[model samples]
Target: SNHQSWVDTSIVQYISRDRLPLTRFFTKFELIYIPIVGQTFYFLDFPMMRRHSKQAVTKNPALAGKDIIEAKRACALLKDKPFTLLNYLEGTRFTPKKRNTQQSPYTHLLKPRAGGLALAINALGDEIDGILDMTIVYPDGVPTYGELWQGKIKRLGVDVRHIEIPDELFASLQDGGYENDSATKEQMFAWVEHLWRQKDERITSMLAEFEE
Candidate 1:
C-alpha cells in the first residue's frame, strides 16, 4: 500500500490481521547494524537490502546486485509457505511537498519506483498467489502517530485490489525483465500508471462520501 501517515501500519495490521498472513517487510540493511530493533527484524526474517550508491557500486563491482540476491535467497525460504511479502513501490511516505517535488501525475501518490518492485517481482513472482494493490486514505485528514495512539482516529478508507499476474509481466520477470530490458520496463511503467490512476479515482470517490 502507498504510505500516507505513520499510523498507516497500525491501521493496516489491525484491519487485516485476520485476512492476511503475517508479513515480512523489505527493510534497509543499515537497520541491522542498529540495536535491538534491527536484530528483531533480522530475527523475524525480514528482507534487509543495502541500497548501494552508484558511486559505491562503481568503486566495488562485487557489491552490485548483492542485496537483491540476498533478498531473493531469504524469499526462497518462504517457498511453499503462506506468507505476505510487502513492497512499497513509492519507496517513501507521501507528502504534498514530495508530490510537488516529483511533479507526480497522481494527486495522492508519489511516483512508483520501478527497480525495487521489479526485484520483488523477480524474486517472488512465481510463488505469490496474487498481486494485492492497496490504497489507504484517511478522509478525516491524516493523523499523526500520536493522534492515532491517543484514540483520535475516527474513519479510514481502504481499497484493496486483487489481480492475477499478467502472463506477459510474469514472463518478463522469469526472463530478466527489470531495468535491463526496455520493452518490459516500459510495460511495467504503463501497468503501474494504470493502477495508480484507478487508485487515485478511488480516493476521489472515497473523499466525496466524506462530504456527503
Candidate 2:
C-alpha cells in the first residue's frame, strides 16, 4: 500500500479473507509498554523492535544491529505455523507534500524501507513459504480512518501478486545473513522497486477506468 490511510488494513483484510490467515504486524518495542492494546499485541506475539532514533544511536553506537536480533528472535515463533505477517513497507502514511519533498520516483508511493522486511525474510526464510505482494488503492482520493468507519468511503481496490522465495536468498544465515550480505540485500531492493513501479502503473491504469 502507498499508505494514504489507516483504513487500508480493514479493506485489504476483507478482500483477502480466506486467502490468508489472520495477520500479525511488526510493532515498535516502545508500543509494547502502552496500555491495554500494546500488551494485547505483545500477547498476540507481534514482533517488536526497539527502534533507535538516529541521534540516540549516534549517542550509543552499540544500539546498532539490535533490531535485527529482536526481529530474528520474534520470527522464531512463526517457524512452527503458517502465519500471515503484515508490513507497511511505506513505513508511514503518504501525503503529497511529503512525497514531493522526498522526490520519490513512484507517483503514489513513499520509498519503502527495505531493511525490516529484509531482516525478517533472512531470519525466517526457511520457515516462510512465499511472499504476497499486495497493492491497495482508493480511486476518489485518500480517506481518513474515520471516514472508513462512518461508511463515507467510496470505491476501494486491491491487487495481489505472489512471489516465491529463492533458495539462495537464505543460503547462509550463519554467515552474516541477508541483511549483512550486500548483494542479496540489493537483489531484494531491486525486486521491491520493480513491484512499486508496477504498482504505480497499475494504479494509473485503474484510475483511468474510473475516468472512462
TM-score of each: 0.92, 0.88
For each candidate, the alpha-carbon lDDT, in order, equals 0.80, 0.76
Per-residue alpha-carbon lDDT of candidate 1 for residues 1-212, written as tens digits (9 for 90 to 100): 88888687777677669899877778887899899989998887777776787899899998887756776886876775687777777888999999999999988889887677778888776676777887788888889999987888888888787866569887796666765688898888888778778887888898888888
Clashing pairs in model 1?
none
Per-residue lDDT tens digits for candidate 2, residues 138-201, read: 7888888888889987787777888665556546432345546778777768767877898889
Pairing residues by index, what is the TM-score of model 1? Answer: 0.92
Best by lDDT: 1
- The superposed Cα distance between candidate 1 and the true structure at residue 32, in angstroms, equals 2.4
